[model samples]
Target: MGADREGGARHRPVRAVAYATCGVVLLAGCASMPDTGDLRDVESTPRQDTQVRVFAMPPREDAGPGEIVQGFLEALTSDDPNYDTARKYLSAEAARKWDPERSTTVLANGPGTAEDNQTGGREDSGNLTYTLVGSRVATVDAQQAYSPAEGPYSRKVHLSRDPKSRQWRIDALPAGVVMGKSDFQRNYMSVNKYYFASNSPAVATGQSATVADPVFVRKRVDPMTQMVRSLLDGPTNWLGPVVRSSFPTGSALQKGVSSLTPDDQNKLIVPLNDRASRAGSGKCAEMATQLLFTMQNLTPAVDSVELQGPSGKRLCELNDDQAVKRPEYLYFLDGKHQMVRIAGATSTSAVPVPGALGTGDRELRSVAVSRDEHTAAGVSIDGKSLYVTELASGASLGDPVVQSHGATTDDRLTTPSWDSHGDLWVADRDRANPRLLLLEQGAGRPVEVQTPELSGRMRIKDVRVAADGVRIALVVEKDHKQSLLVGRIERDEKAGEQPVVTVRGQRSTTPGWEEVTAMSWAGDSRLVVVGREQGGVLQMRYVQVDGSAPDGLAPAALPGVKTIAASEDDRVPLVAYSDDGIVRLPSGGQWQTVVKEGSAPVYPG
Candidate 1:
């Protein structure tokens, strides 16, 4: 099958907020993206030109309404241009009104139940509705916005036979389309739009932490436009509650401009609607930061972001570095659980953490340093208690701020994690009543996290909250099967000083893989997972927050691995405990041992 120049299907973005162009236009817009699809690695399997391939044959001769419904649903998955074949399965009137691009309901691969409702109850007894039910994986909205869903879902198609032709064609149905997971990968592309943490205090300091909102866009369409519009539309429902956007409400792109083009200097030029005309310079700068961080992820990533106001006047321009997330102060505990640090990912030596915690006499089992490096939380070797110590000079250490009643020493708490909001999280893995607790300011009577998704048979093995306060990674085991899952942290909107956050929806980040013994956040939206295939040896790999692994060779195997730690920034190295003892992975090099005596090493977010 040949590849069609005309790309197929409804793809991504947030609802496009069109701006009223005040007679200002950029001629360099939408000038065709480089058509380099052929340059991609060729596939081994024979492919088909979806543009001409008939997905569903026009209902079999004199086909019944049930067949019409089935055929119509099948055609939607076919990448036919404008869904021309799908319309054939619809009545003339329905054909004119039916739109499969309104949205897409992606389902887990399986046979969807198609039931014919022919009870002969209505005035038009022959007129019927066919129901298609399945486990919905996600819903891509009319704007190409994707939102994951849980539980069950059903789709209804109304059909009536063409009396004159003695044939059936769908008459009524929802506007959106439905397809299995395989088709989704073929036509959809995933992109991340960066947004500053909604509740972070770093915003005031011009060093706000950013979070990644992953979204899917059509492969051949104006993805830069789709991504920009989606970023402006805000995060997905699951993530919206936990993040904030710099684009003020009502701000949008210039009307008729669907393409975001880069200037000769590779700086992206974003034309904004009048909604941002009144924004102060500072606000405009923040808005630019959001766009710079987001647009930099696109292919031929932009080096800078230039914002044009309603009047076409330059509001602001910012380089990618200027919009970078602040550098986190990293610290790890040495063999003695004493705070220490490595000069760089390739550095073979370690330095002591700042002040007393580095020189303290406390014997600890595990330690976690705050983002600011001002405090540290350590669990006792017995694992029954948690302690917090000031990292300042001669600062005193606090008594056990948290205690557990684990029946055995092995059923104790794991390492603690510090979020951008100064909150510490840890999991108490008591086999009987496992608990995930959030301790404010490094310690205290923990607030049992109310994430119902993590409840039930599974026991929590490890929990690490990302530097961005909105996400958490957990490794759990149930009936001997261990898996890695990530959850979005939600908090009360008005929970000002005393914030209360819970792990709302926890889903697998390393799906299908079992024996996920160790995992850590490698970046805002990436995780370094140490997983073992069923009955296979342990292998270390990287996975996205969306559960997809990075395409390429897995990192060199680090057998006999006990645990791992990674800096929140992807630029930082990934450190792990392996047969070679403490080892680190350079940017593009093999893993090299950094410390022979190190155990459970970590980079503080």
Candidate 2:
């Protein structure tokens, strides 16, 4: 099913405070009596399937130093909107200086506290210190960007007795909130902020090629308002170079606009400040389109978005269909090793493409059609040679554009992929001399792309370049395990010098999977991955580029999936080669057999 349709069904509104009492049970485990003075193992309480609202209690009068520290740490994981209760455990000056929004540090387990001062126990002492320690898992920056982290984490919290009340209070602490992995997952959700590809020709012509910049935001905390603010604030630091926001510079939501809710008709009206009043009709429409795409995953599904100026004048409006693209044709190789295509998601019959590669004159193992659908690149059955051919009836099979010298078929070239810029990319798995090559416009000498981050025994198993031409997803093998990673593509094009293409900032997108068998870009920032976790059965799930799962349920189970195909346009059904033969999952429908003998299914790039 299309991601949008499936997401709508999965995102229906649920009570936010369904399990209010559960918070006491979860947080009580972190606290200790004033007399014990003992350190306990810190662990995260498992999250429930439904939304949970955790309310934290304020520190009691005359609380001991250990109790104050534990109360503050437990409060960090609560749903207290402004963290007011958490601040109660801090001194007056420290409470005023603390900024919980600075950044969030996630630990493998919840933070554990240990008394650092060696002085003999004395209630008369005015000062104390405690050590907070845990293993780091990931971090969320001020921009709401999530990045996986590793290694040990250690910080200090200082406490002092209040001269007026003679109560223990935290004098100093970390800048932002700290929590365990489970609490992080429960408190924040992954959201994709839409932007236009900065380098695409479509942008110059007033058209848009949508790109997704994923970020994390607090759930049930007026998320609609947060998402709108994030969209206007622009893309994150890592993706800022390749994408551009449609909102005008200095544009922001109207002052004092704390909550944004869609109307009964599911139409959202966004009121912008005076800075956006100067935007023309065309630019306003583009801005509305960006919001429309960004709000697709929200509950009740916003059917339309309208942009309003400072004076409450409607500048432009956009509907869901107007902002989303429909799926194109589905391309694949038949049992006879011929490239064929179906019209679209609803088409029942498949026809051989009008090209030399479809005539079966030259046997092929796998094929990739260019984004424009004018040309195709195929790898031989033995996987030694790579050929490019025209999609014309009279065209002839030409000479091999590239060849591999691997000793066996399994070590030869992988399936080729095309970027939106018409460039072709493939990885030669030759153990003796492996390399990633890029062919500009699918012709001429292939250039070896630089991947300095992929050192050691890492080897590329599969490659899929995003439609934006600036990001590439690769399945790499290391130590007999397969992992999916996404990297940025930077091209240095000088008029008189050779172009140098490099892949940098590679990050793991499926760290838990032991084997990533196959994957395809299912949406702007989402991929449908087929893989298995350690000692687990193979399954298919949609994961964002940031290694976080999306909001909807996973795709229905399929057996022995060898290859999968999906389009960036979510309107298309997902096609896969499985034990049941070629099957498709239609929107709001089950997987149905498309053909009994097809392999290597793919959609136009």
Candidate 3:
């Protein structure tokens, strides 16, 4: 053994018994055991109701190769800050070469060792090899980006016994760490890394719409510092092209400043390197805003963030209230099929808006209001036509801007969504020819948006454009199952040519759900989704655009949900159409009936 040599000798007598007892308790609590088959399959460990702190114990004297390997695997999942105890089972050289933070491989279950498959020389030769195997679930890379992974996983662990002490030690092993899905969830949490939308027109106006890039970081392992570093590192590869960081090129945290904590007043002071000092006051303020938003979910909630240059001079500061806008009214169809509005956070009663659509001139199916709240779009009850009109009183509903030729309502147009740029987007699911269309300012000729991956068996079921106008969330159907996908919105404009638009690099944001019934953008990069896992009941939860589960408890469950709505400003209550008709969930409150009959609840983009 490596560092365990001294400690192992001193505690061998006492810890040996304790380790056996702990092992028994852990095994008893396991949901299922690994079977002795060609592929040893172990179920994920059940999560405990209360937090359990597990400490790693140094290896006992003269441990066998199997014991050393098992102990090392167990230690990797412990609460050890630096995994010092895990290294104790490795050879000195192997321990020095290991880099646990390189990446994390999550498996459906804890890895199982196959002792029967052990190879290499006999015990006398002091050389042996064992295999650890499991089914891969996902991976968190060096940049903290999380991606779902599939297929079987197998790795070899080589061991050699010290000739003098005759103690088995790992001489070679895989880099990073591997653990069951439950353990991974216990150790890691998702954080949103804010970035400016590169293609948004708002950026040119100095407003710079923010887009969230979610990443996973260890929950108890200096997460504040980890999140800061991840933010400076830029967006994940999938979102890189559509977003830009406000921090100057090569900007980084001041060297040797590792841990970060908010002060008693909930202010976090960040010290940046020389590169950040080059930014002007305006850009520096944007950078501070990014930090304020990124750190908003930390425990106790950071109220403000202040950035300092290398020379310890203040660059800028931003408070939470100044960094984000307050949510507006909740919009939905009333019992009479007329559009109605209510205060998103407080109103209990709903009233029709001042417009032709609100006056019930034409029956509506679903609706979307522009970000400016100056205009509105509505789909026909038959899902065949889309109508646009102003929100002002006496404003007339114009002729259908777009229509679908589908034979039935189930195969026609979906609810419309307006982007920050005032553009409108929707999917026409006509069985003969399904297509996604976008309109300029909600009035121009529909542009057929290209979606190469959505052909063949897949078709768009619903559409929700993000506030940044650079991303779109879509519910896609294939073989009767619906999946939520987030795709980058790419626009190509050339002189004298029709501006081409495409939804590219689409990735599933609801990998765990077998069917996604409805979803809405709840924040810059978060969505409130109503879905169900295979053979599971329908449930509502918040998920990041990057396919990672966000921190905090999931919303209290509501049954029979048909559609859901959430505001970019999270302070707004969530509204949904369910068996009980229109229902709203206020902050820290249960679902309350808003009306006996209503459908297609929504918040302005």
Q: Relative to the true structure, how large is the alpha-carbon lDDT of every model?
A: 0.67, 0.80, 0.79
Residue lDDT tens for model 1, 1-605: 00000111111111221122233211111112112111111111122232222233445576655445555655555435467767887788988987766788877653254445354424246576656666677777765555556567666767776668867577887787776666565556566677777754563355676788776665534557878888888887667777888788888898978577678887998999888656888888878877766665545346777888876899888875432343354355577767676665556677776665577787677788777766888787788888777767777766777777888876888888888767888888887778888877766567777777765888888888987777888888888889888888876635445556678777776655779988887655667888777777778887777665443355677778878887655556667888787887776788887878766687765
* TM-score against truth, every candidate: 0.75, 0.87, 0.87
* All candidates in order of lDDT, best leading: 2, 3, 1
User: Residues 1-605, candidate 3, lDDT per residue (tens digit)?
Assistant: 00000111111100010111122123211122222324343344455322444556777887766668767877777667788988998999999999998889998888877643444335566777767898898888888788888899898888888988888899999999998988788767666668888865673346877877778876555678888988988888888888888899999999989778889887999999999888999899889877876776433346788999877899888876633345467888988899998875666688898888899579899999998888999999889999999999989987899999999998999999998888899999998999999998898789999998776899899999998899999999999999999999988877776678889999888886789989998866678898998888888988777776765667788989999988766666788999999898877899999887788988887
Quick one: best lDDT, which candidate?
Answer: 2
- Clashes in candidate 1: how many? 2
Ranking by TM-score: 3, 2, 1
Q: What is candidate 1's TM-score against the reference? A: 0.75
Per-residue lDDT of candidate 2, residues 1-605 (tens digit):
11222434111111122222333333552265342334454566567543556667788776788788888888887777789989999999999999998899999888876776554445567887777889898898989988778899889888889888999899999899998988887878776678887754452235656777888887746678888998999998888877788788999999978778779888999999988878888788889878887777544357788888877888889876533334357888888888888886777698998868888577788889888788889999899999998888978778899999999987999989998778899999999998999998899999899999997699999999998788899999999999999988877777776578888889998876799999998877789999999899989988778776566678888888999998876667899999887899987789999999888998877
Clashes of 2: 0
Better of 1 and 3 by TM-score: 3
